[model samples]
Target: MTNIDVKDINTLTLSILEGADSYYRWIFQEIKPYLQGGILEVGCGMGHLTNWLLGEGKVLVADINKSYLQMVERRFKNHSNWMGGIVWDIQEDPPEDFPLSVHTIVCINVLEHIRDDLSILKRFYKLLPLRGRLICLVPALRWLYNPLDKGLGHFRRYSKKELCEKLTLTHFRILTLRYFNLFGAVGWFLQGTVLRKRLLSSVQVNWFNRLVSLFISIESRIPSCFGQSLIAVGEKS
Candidate 1:
């Protein structure tokens, strides 16, 4: 593992894992189809998304925090598909050091932290082979940016247009790009914007998780014009 300054963990990301099983599971299912070959998951904090990707393929989990990587490595120690964890700073690290087996890169809820997201996207592009996929999920709606986003060290939230443009600029073919979790958007607005809460309590997460199935059912049929997050899959062609 590469040595670097370990920053404070993303409290917002860790808090969501408290009781949001169904919520994360839904996200996993949505992105699972795009996963192929060996996968390198960027910003794999505490292994929330990594847990789901365990059996999907060979998973090389990478994060800036050494502690988080150690935890993930310990948690999945027995799993054959676990390809070990690395301490990586995407903005600073050269892509040439990544294992050649990596064909799909899954980055969930991580891009917002970087001010130079375009540079990181180009780095991700260089880390892959032909037809390699970049499965990315990010907070959507600039209007929804609030104290909670700031607390999480997020530089900016993203619009579909903004994300698509960045991915395209990196020379990736846009494969899947759309909005996700309308219900999450509503709750986020109430807590972050209306109530001025910087974090979602475990009680709130549990309540919302219980209804995740219903939310998924409804969102699947409705036109996803807007959402709490944007999910995009780009392919290196």
Candidate 2:
């Protein structure tokens, strides 16, 4: 296991994990179709899904953030069957040491943060072997922009059409692109636009977080509904 130097690893884990259990469940369900053999997760912050993916064969946790990568490595050292972490640079071009051949790639909530999302997509498209799958999840609704979005370093939110066009341009055939987390859209609207809260207090976030997950659970039991986030599964063709 690689060592991740951080003053407060536990706090970081707790921060991301609080509202993410539901999101991760939805993500796993959505990404199940594309996953196989060698898999790579871009921007795998704090090993949220790292431990689960490690159970599968040939799982590589790749991110540019050295600290995040180390956190994953140190946390999941017990699962050594097929586990490794790599320092990956998605901008410009993939670093030489990063895996050249991969079957499935999951890029979640990281595209908007990237300076050149399209170029990264193109490079990812080329990196995959024939018939490889790519799972991409990006924030939806450009109007929901707020200070948290800026603080998180997101360049832009994506609409369904805009995201699809970019994916198509990258030589990927969109197998599925559906909206996710509909309730969160309303939450974002209220906080991002109406109140315009820059950052969230822990208690406030936990309360809203529970509400979001509860609504998501209800939605999961029900049939279907529109969502604020867009999740797409594409294949290199």
Candidate 3:
């Protein structure tokens, strides 16, 4: 973990995440099937996910932080599939100019930052057309939450039951819902609870990244009852 203040913690975290290429590609594989038509990625953040999704479709990135939005746009503006980006606060109603052409909305590690996550899920439900998909990945296990969660501005870590219930309540028919990153869960617990670390170390992330393929292999064959994160795919029926 680098020496950083709370306000800059997100940027620091994203920087660290830049090295977790294998981990993210594991995520990309899980959600790739659901990605279709106009893809509206809710929190592009330094465009890590956006980079993988460049030529996938009409990729429109949105984020409340204008600086992050502009940075992501500038990073991929020249791509043929880059539809540009917009500054959007998911807590409020999507702007009138929000595109109706979006058939899928991808939210990665963003919902945990919201206080009323249900309201935003409802908004996403309203924003999509029939059979449109809502793909989300969020940190799991509230018991594992640590100072790292606080510094990263996470409101709460989600439970499998809670996520499913919310998606059901929001009128999204569940497609794929499951725990992910089994090894990462152990590392998170050790770092946060056992070691009592407030920030992540760059060396640790790179080490973990190198082993992500092995983790993916193990996770694929073994059905996990719990994990460090949850990936849910819900369809607006």
TM-score of each: 0.93, 0.84, 0.95
Candidate 3: C-alpha RMSD to true structure equals: 1.7
Off by over 4 Å in 2: 1-14, 97-101, 208-214, 220-225
Cα error, residue 205 of model 3, in Å, equals 0.7
Backbone clashes, candidate 3: 1
By TM-score, the better pick of 1 and 3 is 3
Q: Give the best candidate by TM-score.
A: 3
Candidate 1, residues 1-237: lDDT per residue as tens digits? 122112332544485675687888999999989999999999998888888898798899899889888888889989988888888888886545655399999999989999999999998898789999999999999999987777667899998889999999999999889999998999889988998765566788889889999999999999999999999999999
Over 4 Å off in model 1, which ranges?
Answer: 1-9, 12-16
- Write the residue-wise lDDT of candidate 2 on 129-201 in tens digits: 8789888889898878775566456689888889999999999999999888787777767766787654444
Between candidates 2 and 3, which one is better according to TM-score?
3
Quick one: ranking by lDDT, best first?
3, 1, 2
Q: Tell me the lDDT of model 3 at 111.
A: 97
